[model samples]
Structures are given as structure tokens and as C-alpha cells.
Target: MQPLVVLISTFTLIFVASYASLQPAETYWNSVLPNTPMPKTIQDRLMSGSVHDWGVSKIHPDICAFYIFFPLCIGSNIKAKDDPRRYIFLTESDLKLGTKKNLYLMKSSNNANFLPQKVDDLDASTSKNLTVAINLLLSHPTSAEAKDMRNTIDMCEAGEDNACATTLEAMLDFTTSRLGNNIDTLISEGDTEVKIQSYSISDLKIMKSKKSIVCHKLTYPYAVYKCHSMSDTRAYKVSMVNANGKKINVGVVCHIDTSRWSPKHLAFEVLNVKPGTIPVCHLVPGDSIAWVPNEL
Candidate 1:
């Protein structure tokens, strides 16, 4: 009887080892292959850091076009009231609506900057920060919300999109909130209440003198964004007035340098101008954020 048990255990061990060996070397991490195939147009925009739409179809068509060709429209002196292009940007209400509908897709824009890292590969400081941020947002590190966020992030990192489909809001909120907290911490210490400033698209005004971080709301199953500071860029506060007359303040950023951008880029095509000839700008959708110095 003892010999039979030993033989069975040996066979189980061999089977497990063989199965693991057959898997890809990157099986241990989310998004094992970083260089996945993407559309040339998207790839070009990403490379130039001038992407307007991160494949989010939920946004309005007119608004999307405006974002794609903002450089042309803004330069043309087109008045928001006279211009046929209705700038109907998303609002807080729209964000909460249908939160459960598109989550099944579980697709990300696949931006390299927002990709999840393997737990083991994350530095000690980063891991600690993530844990602290999650706790801050969810109130308890071991709470159900925190657990869900951690799982969603892990799944997204592991390229298990299908498995991450259900908790789209949690994933989106966690990333944005964590980033917001980081922004607050960056600006001041000791639990400073971060006051985010917003502007509207209808009344676009640029702050040329101030440096700021623009967080653009990305199109995904849920809210996600690619926020960063751009050199040679200007920030604007655009007043976004929806059809219902509800006002939302939005952030807009214009890139001043396009000398190295691809000539075939959409901005050049839309504006009928050559690359490096003009500045390109786009609005920061609702639920997104931007950080500027408090003095401004």
C-alpha cells in the first residue's frame, strides 16, 4: 500500500512539472509579451505621444474628431457657438451610466506606460507605495474593495483580460485615485487635500506660464488614462457645457513641438499643414485630472 501511494505521488509531480514546462516562459507575469501587434495608425500616434483616442468608442463622434484635429480647429478661430462641431464632452453622470455593460471586453489601450508589472519584479518602494495607496483609497488593505482592485491589476498585468472584465470600475477607480493621491503627495506632504482645478471646452483658456500634468481620460471598458507632463506644452481650462446646460471644467494640453512627428499624422492631415508647422491640442475628458501649481 505504501509503495502504491509513493508511485501515485511521483506520477502527479511529473505531470505538474511537464505542464508548467510546456507553458510560455512569461506565464508567470501579466502581459508576457510587450511587443504585441497593434494598428499602424495607433502605433504612430502613440510613438509621437499625440494620441487622441485610445480606441474608446463610447465618446461622441464629433468630440472625437475635435480631439483628433484640435490643432486645426483652434488655429482657425472657430467659435464654439458658431462652429458646427458640437463639443459635447463626457460628464460624471455619463461615467456612472452603463458601468457594467462594456466591461466584458476587458481590453486596454495597451499603452506601454500603464502596463502592469509582475509582483516579483516591482521594486520594494513601489510595492510599498501601491499597498499604501490602495489602503488609503479603500480604507483597509484587506478589504473586499482592495482585494478586488489588487486582483484586477494583477489580472491586467498578466494579460488575463477576460478574467478582469467584471471589475472594470474598481480597476479604473483604483488607478485614477492612486495617481491622484500621488499627485497630492508630490505637491505637498502630510495629507494635503489635493484641490484639482478644471476648465471647460467652450471657454478654452491656456496657461502658458505654468507647467502641469495632464490626465486624459482613456477609452476603455471603464475609465483609464495616460497622464504625464509634457515639455514645450501648454495647458488650457475649457468650460464644457453639455446639452442639459450642466457645466464641467476640463483640461486641455497643446504640444508645441511637432518637428519630429510623422508627416502622415492625423493632425497634419486634418489641418492641411506640414509636421513641425503647428501646435496640436486636445481636451482632457471628464473623470480625468490635471495638476498645476496652487499659485496659478
Candidate 2:
């Protein structure tokens, strides 16, 4: 009994001295950076209840390995010493050819001192297709399309400087084209469902967690699209787990277009997807569960 009590006390002490003691992400930026200001957009991302561990590193003088919470997550990743940050702020305009990283807003007032680095594309097809799609939208688009494009570009600027979130906005139409209104129907069109490794959307596995956040960003595809001007999206509270196997609650948010339900008009139509059966893109509804534990 005595030993058990001591063990519990020690664990609590360690947690309080470590995770709880760390200040809000913005504090680190202010202490280490000159004239660091908090943009409302960045704050909105953080306040969404997702804080990613960006881990610490001495990669660059102007940069320490940190994160933008989940979207605007901040923190010193304490995992590997001197681990380099290979994070890329993915968005629609970032579809330029041949780059390790894609960034629309390279620097901003709030994160001026916290320089972000570049990394490789997640997939050539995704980037190339998205790039072509964005260009197409630029050519004589509808009033809404034009507004959407302008907003995405300006997302890099302050007040609403959240290029990552805007990236989702940019890709909203594309993902919708692929998934359409009934995601289950599209995924079931062929053996494509097997490739996804789960029949039920609930069974999908997560990224090979370098570490886990009890509740991670509802970073499902097309999820960011909900943040767009044309689409309707809202906040929903959810739970997730971290690398430590602890439970974490998070909010998943993204969509800007209305025909988000039509497959022909979603990602499929935007990417000009040809075919008999194309791969089913991830489509989490604005108010639905995007990701959850395998047990649930």
C-alpha cells in the first residue's frame, strides 16, 4: 500500500513539473522573438482545443523546432534531442512544382521570429492535381470562386493569418469532388475500400504517431474545407489519445462550398478525376466524428 501511494505521488509530481509547468505556446514566441504579436486567426486555431507537441530542436537560430498547436499549435517537442522540424504548412496555393515544403505564408507578424522550414510533398499526384485545380479556379471563376481564391491568398497575412487553415479552404472543392455527399457510397464503389483498411469510417488508423495527442486535430481530408466562406462549418468537441496512451479531448473543424455533398462536384470533379473507380478521399462532416479510438 505504501509503495503504491509513493508511486502515484511520484507520477503526479512529474506530470505537474513537466507538462503542466510549460507556458502557453505564445509565451515562448514572445520571450525568444522580437515584436511577436498574436494574430486573431492563430489564436482561434489554438483556442480550438488542440495543442500539438512541436518538439524542440536547434535546427536554425531563427527557428527552434516548434509546432502551431494542431493548426496553430505551439510547444517544445521534448522527444529526441536536436530533432529537425520537417513540418510543411499544406494548403491549395502551395502546389508549385518541385519543392520539399509548401508554404503560402512564409512569415507573419505573430510568427515573424518563428521561421517555418520546407519539406517534401505528401504525394506528387495530390500536389500536382491541386496546383492545376487552383489555377483553373483562377481563370474566370464565379463570384464565390473568385472570393474564395482571394481569401486563401490573403490568409497568409495577419489578423487571419492561418495559411494552413486556408489551405483546407483551397482544397475544399477538390476533396468534395472525390468524396461527394455520401462518403460511404463512394468508398464502396470497389476494392478501394480495402486499400483504406477499414469498411467503417470509424476503423481507420491514425498517422504513425511519433507521439500521440489524446485528441489530435480532426485533420481528415476535406475537413479544412469547412473553414471556407461558401461552406458551412462549426465547432464540435471530441476526444483522442496521445503517444503516452492518455486520453485527450480535441475539436475538429473545416468546408466552404455548398455542393459538398455531390461527388461529381467535390474533389473528384475538381481534380478532373477520370474513371471507373477512383480512390475515396477522406470526408469528415463538419459536425461528425472525424477520428476516434479503434475500440469505439
Candidate 3:
């Protein structure tokens, strides 16, 4: 009996440990992937830098140092607001280009007495521009403009001007509105159409004296509540009621069906409205209704 007791205790500890370690999986199946929009300002900055040869300095001492250190300094400051998950670090190519531009400015200055002063000024300006470009690119890495820039860079490296020109023209059309009015068009072209799930609410009950009611105990994957209308289906909004019958705005999450007219009840998990309070069910005039237990 003592050995059996010890065995049961060991099993209980294992069960508890496993249950405690369990975590909910990411809800990726229902999540929407964000769309990338072209950043005009960043593209313009890149174009300006390329045309003026802003950072074209010697490879060994000037350009290499600037490229290696400057981006690390500036990249640390860049951040995204809406989705922090979207931020990306600078690529090796981007770093190389930035370094080359800075080195060019350092080498081309003629004022020997003011060389340090001039370099400092140039560094400040370049830092600001770098920050803006990096932030915008990271924020919209998959944008049409970014893609075009990538392709153009590739073509130039491969010594194929004709192919680059063709790609650039398509990019020009995207910028000039030939592609469509908004970024949504570009996103839609690449993404699957998202379908909205709808549900019907059939039976509802409000307890006049109780503060809380159980709506439905669901083991289903997902649920939504909607009301039946002859003209069109409408979603039912839940509202809280004060003792004086005045409605108070509150957010409620529950699932119910309203399509059928019957006395059968749907059970919901326990909801805390308020202790000793009554619930009032508000529906269309012809809606079927039933009472829900406080505990499911």
C-alpha cells in the first residue's frame, strides 16, 4: 500500500509539471500579414546620395571605418511604432554603400585647416539621412520601391542596363499612380482574400435579480454572435444595464445562436456581470429566448 501511494504521488507530480509548462500556440492561422508600402522620401534620399557621390572615399582608412562604425551607431536609434516585430537590421550591401558615400565626402574636401570641422558637419548630416533611410526601409522592407531598388542594384552589378531600365520603368509606374490608387492594391495582388465569419444568436435570457449569467460553454475553435433580420443579417451588440434600467457601455465577449425560435437553451461559461443583479435580454421583437444558468 505504501509503494502504491508513492507511485500515485509521483504520477501526480509529473502531471502537474507537464500541465504547468503547457502554453497556448501562436494564433497565426487567424492572423493577417501586414502590407508593405513604398517610402518615397527614403527612395529620394538614396537617389540624391547616388547622384552626388556623397560618401565615395578611399577604401582603407576612411570609407571602411565610416561604414563599419556609423551604421552601428545610427541603426541603434531606429525603431518601429505599430509592430515592433517588423524591424530589420541593415544588410551588408546597405552598410557598404553608406560607408563608401561617407568616405567620398571626407576625401574630396579642399580646406586642410578645416578638414576635421568639415568632416564633423558632414557626419551630422549623413547620420540624419542614414537614420531616415534605414528607418523607412526597415518599416517597409517589402515595398515596391525597395524591391525595384534591389533589382536595379542587381542589374547594375551584372552590367545589364537594358534589364535595369525595364524594371525601373515598372517601378516608375508604381510611383506615378499607374499601378492603382493605394498600397492596398499591391497588398491584395500578393495576399489571399480574407473571409469574415458570421454567426446567428437564437436564444438569450436576462436575469432580473442576478448580476451575472452564463452565456454559452463553447469547446468550438471560434464563435461570433449575429442577429437574424429579414432584410439583412446584423451583429448583436452586448450592453450592460444599471438597476434603474439605464444601459451602460461595456465590452462583452460571448457566442450565441439566434436563427431558431425555441425553448432549448445554450450553455455558456460563467460570466461576472455583478452579484445579485438581473440581466435583461434585448433582441428584435420576434426573437426566441431562454434562461441561462449562472454556472455552466
If the candidates were sorted by their lDDT against the true structure, best first, what order would they fall in?
A: 1, 2, 3
Residue-level lDDT of model 3, residues 43-122, one tens digit each, is: 22121112113221111121111111122221234422221111111111222211211000112111111011112222
RMSD of each: 19.8, 21.9, 31.2
lDDT of 1 at 188: 10
Error of 1 at 133 (Å): 19
lDDT of each: 0.33, 0.24, 0.20
What TM-score does prediction 2 earn? 0.19
lDDT of 2 by residue, 1-296 (tens): 00000111122232223323334445543443323243333333322111122211111211221222222122344432222221211222222223122111122112111111110111112232433334432454344444433333333232221123222212222323332322110000111111112111112222211111111122211112222111132222223322333332323222223243454332334344433333322222212223211121
Off by over 4 Å in 1: 1-204, 216-226, 240-246, 294-296
lDDT for each residue of candidate 1 in 127-192, tens digit (9 for 90 to 100): 224464453334456755455345334433332111121122222233333333222101110111
Best candidate, TM-score-wise? 1
What's each prediction's TM-score?
0.33, 0.19, 0.15
